[model samples]
Target: MKAVIQRTANANVTVDNQKVGEIEEGLVVLLGVTHEDGLEDAEYLAKKITNLRIFEDDSGKMNRSLKDVDGSLLSISQFTLYGDTRKGRRPNFMQAAGPEAAEELYEQFNDFVRKENVPVETGKFGAMMDVQLTNNGPVTLILESRE
Candidate 1:
């Protein structure tokens, strides 16, 4: 499992002009599942993301965890993260998990995050979603369960 985490002041996802999910003062998690991902990977990533000290402290240091700041999360399923474009103009998605498997793990990841008591909003899986966010600090990071 992999994630592109971005700190945001506000975010929302729309499907066909309808808002599906939204959040404020949180992280936008673009989550991807690979063929090798499992429940353990999802669990590990959820725990780590919730506890990462990426938020600023009173002194302006990035020292507060998402839980510490009472923040929320916008989780989006993103199979494209695994697109392999090494040898072709068109990318290959061989590394991405099958739809059924990916959706299961994606839900597991969200459930795990919610278990940590942090609010989780999500876009519809496998749908074409339009996501908008005001990226606070423009802070972005990539995290992988296996890494």
Candidate 2:
């Protein structure tokens, strides 16, 4: 599993001109699932993301966790994160999990975050989504379960 986590002032996802999910003062998670991913991978990422101290604290240090800042989560399924572009001009998605399994894991990931007491919103699974966000501090991080 991989997560491209971005701190955001606000974020939303739209599908077919209809808003699917939205959040404010939270993180926008572009989540990816590989063939090897399972519940354990989702569990690890959820814990890590919610506890990550990316928010600023007194004296301007990034020391506050999502919980500390009372933030929410906008999770979006993004199989393209596994795109391997090292070879040719085209990116290969062989490492990404199949759609059915990926969607299951995606839901499990959101359930884990919600269990952590962070308000969780999500984009439509397997849909072409238009995501918009005001990235807070421009803070972005990529997290992977394997390494």
Candidate 3:
């Protein structure tokens, strides 16, 4: 499992021109699942991201966790994170998990994050979505379970 997390002032997801999910003063997570991913991977990322000290504290230091900042989460499944472009002109997606398995893990990841007591919003698992966000501090990080 992999996730691209971005601190955001606000975020939203739209599908078929209809808003599906949204959040304010939180993180936007673009999550990806590979064939080897399981519940453990999902749980691991949830814990890591929720506890990550990316938010600024009283002294303007990046020392506050999402919990400390009272933030929310907007999670979206994005298999494209596994797109391997090392070869020819086209990107290879062979490392990405099949839709059925990926969707299950995606839901599990969101559920685990929710268990951390932070509000969670999500895009449709297998839908084409338009995501919008105002990135706070432009802070972004890429996390992966395998390494």
Q: State the C-alpha lDDT per candidate.
A: 0.98, 0.96, 0.96
Best by lDDT: 1
lDDT of 3 by residue, 1-147 (tens): 999999999999999999999999989999999999999999999999999999999899999999889999999999999999999999999999999999999999999998999899999988999999999999999999997
Tell me each candidate's RMSD, in Å, in order: 0.5, 0.7, 0.6
State the number of backbone clashes in model 1: 0
Structure candidate 3, residue pairs in collision? none
Q: What TM-scores do the predictions have?
A: 0.99, 0.98, 0.98
Model 3 worst lDDT window (10 residues) = 118-127
- In model 2, the runs with Cα more than 4 Å from the true position are none
Ranking by TM-score: 1, 3, 2
Q: How far is 60's C-alpha from truth in model 3 (Å)?
A: 0.6
The number of residue pairs in model 2 that clash at the backbone is 0
Clash tally for model 3? 0
Worst 10-residue lDDT window, candidate 1: 138-147
Across 44-79, the per-residue lDDT of candidate 2 in tens digits comes to: 999999999999999799999999999999999999
